[model samples]
Target: MSLITFHRIYPSAIPPMRGDKSALGSLPAAAFQYCEAIRTASSFGWYVFPPLDIELKFDGAEVFCFAEESGWNKLSSLYFEDEFWREWDRFAPDDMKGYRIPYLTTLFVPGIVQIWSGLLVSTASDYSVLVRPLANVVSHRGYQVYEGIVETDRFAPCPLFINIRLIDTSRAIEVYQRDPLFQVQAIHRSCYADGGAYAEKIGLGPPDGVTHGMSATEWDGLRSTIRSAQPLRDSQIGRYGAAVRKRAKGQENID
Candidate 1:
């Protein structure tokens, strides 16, 4: 099996772990039984934790980062190398002439900010990594997480951080050391090929359709599936999830 690992890069760094059911802990038991989509998504990748506790406050003009622990006074105040920032600014687009946002900047723009995850991720040689917000769980206090895919195999042990766009800046946002900050999932490098066949759909659609190839008999079957028709038997509520699990297990049988 291909292995993915996370290295703790700082004294307060915490290693990532498989996502749990906390995101769905508030849902009623009955309501959660059929939440396979959310459950699957939440558990698909590992959760990345923050290195320290911080509270970010905004007054419609600027953002201030504060820390209440020793050796961690603030996020942006932490020391960072300027090598990448210098090179990036030099080759930046002409339109962004006067914009120079540092990698460790607490505030990138008026309402956008960056947070250091304090972890380095490593993956198999042929696989990359996708770093993004927790799937199906919204806990932003006042901002929205951004998604970024990195060819981590190139850098191997890549630094993992997060950038969020402020949505409701009227309140202060806090990040606890015990809480998850982001998520990381592995993806094959081949998925990024120039002309890869990423997906296909069969129907009378505007694009990516096989309208001319779908025969009447095929459409009848497809329609029945979409309509959830069970004329021969009673309909099932979690039938889609059951079918998905069956497909995932394939034809394998365990005794």
Candidate 2:
């Protein structure tokens, strides 16, 4: 079975960077509880919570837009340390230079992961689990929305980028401390492939099951008798062994 593991580059908790005057404070206990639940729920995947707080403010239409000709169209105002931003930016595809879309403003992601082979990791909205920015934290904060999904290598450990984008440009939003900024789900790599054929048809089913294998009605009767409330004595055990040998011989004859 494959596994996914996480590591935090920052040793201590960091405070969220604010573009405006939103006050930073400890989030509700429910926020941390929800994250813990997701973290320990299963062995297949894990959750990465925000190590620090973050905020973005959009004053009406001034800082966001869908207009291709507008300077404020789809801008990312989120900020992080220069070194951290540089490190995460290293993973961006080189062909991005030719793309005309708004540049993905890099932020210092709170977590990293060792994405395993035979699995893929993708992002989910933090709001899905009730982890979100401070409500009504600022005027015009509703304009920006967090971006979804980051590219992950199926077999290597890499830094996870928490990307955001402007949606309405009507308001501002803040990501509080301990918020679940990035959610990762592991997917079997085979899911991406086209299934070839049934296992039994491909000679991959259980070796001695009914499908393509032997059938001994006497063995079935013996199994039923053993499973019943009646206690088995030495005589019954001896009979079972004889039945097993008989079944093996019958299977050999069929082969």
Candidate 3:
């Protein structure tokens, strides 16, 4: 079982707001359904979530949004603590220059700020984790953005970020002091004790006694030199389709 340790970096960050039956006077059908799902997933070692919230703001948007070369010097003072975001501006690459577009009057906002300023840790040695934005808040802005799969090791854990793309950039948006920002889902890898036996059982081989795994045709299929070519094992789905067809034929004969 994998474990995630969520430490509250800032004192202001708060747990996500969960509306439960006991807290509320009455519960809706969806709320009850979600609660049941949470309970069921918890038993099987899943972190359905209540991720830590991080603060982000586009301070003095009116002024910074209009800033050019002459106004660029003044744009640095727009962050919560003026100097706090300075380091980010310096290290950001040319492509990421658009991220600090407060210097330029632009329609799209980039890198408003990094929410989590500190570190996060995961117990899993090497794993793929997902960072998802709060669904309710994601729809607040017209366009939805997805964060890629983060690979976590013993070193530094992946920090979550909020990517908000507004349909109407003119409208001012604010993330309250303690609003839930994002959630993290730790993706688990599928494991099999005996790979050879499993593949044979799945109908991709020359049966149990004939061969352990990887039939002659399957091995020959892997001889492709193309880097983007699909693996031979991918075609193993045909095994299941064949089984279904055989079962249908048997049923027709009986009928």
Best by TM-score: 1
- Sort order, lDDT high to low: 1, 3, 2
Output the lDDT of residue 105, model 3.
23
- Candidate numbers, best TM-score first, in rank order: 1, 3, 2
lDDT of 2 by residue, 1-255 (tens): 233343444333332222111112233444323332222222223334444444443454333223224433434433334555455456558754232211224233321111111122322222112112233233223333343333343323444444444344444454544543333544434434358333543222345454453347645755554525455633343333344445756844321
- Lowest-scoring 10 consecutive residues by lDDT in candidate 3? 46-55
Per-residue lDDT of candidate 1, residues 1-255 (tens digit): 555778765546677878765463654565457656766777888888877766676667666666454532334545333554455467768785555433345655776777677677788888888889886676676778888888878887877778787666677677787978888899887787678645555566334435345667877877545524567665566655666666778943321
lDDT of 3 by residue, 62-96 (tens): 22322233432322223223353465556658665
Model 2 clash count equals 10
Q: Candidate 1: which pairs clash?
A: none
Which candidate, 2 or 3, would have the higher TM-score against the true structure? 3
Candidate 1 vs candidate 2: the lDDT winner is 1
Q: Which candidate is the best by lDDT?
A: 1
Deviation of model 3 at 49, angstroms: 12
lDDT of each prediction vs. the true structure? 0.68, 0.36, 0.39
The TM-score, computed over Cα atoms with residue i paired to residue i, of candidate 3 is: 0.41
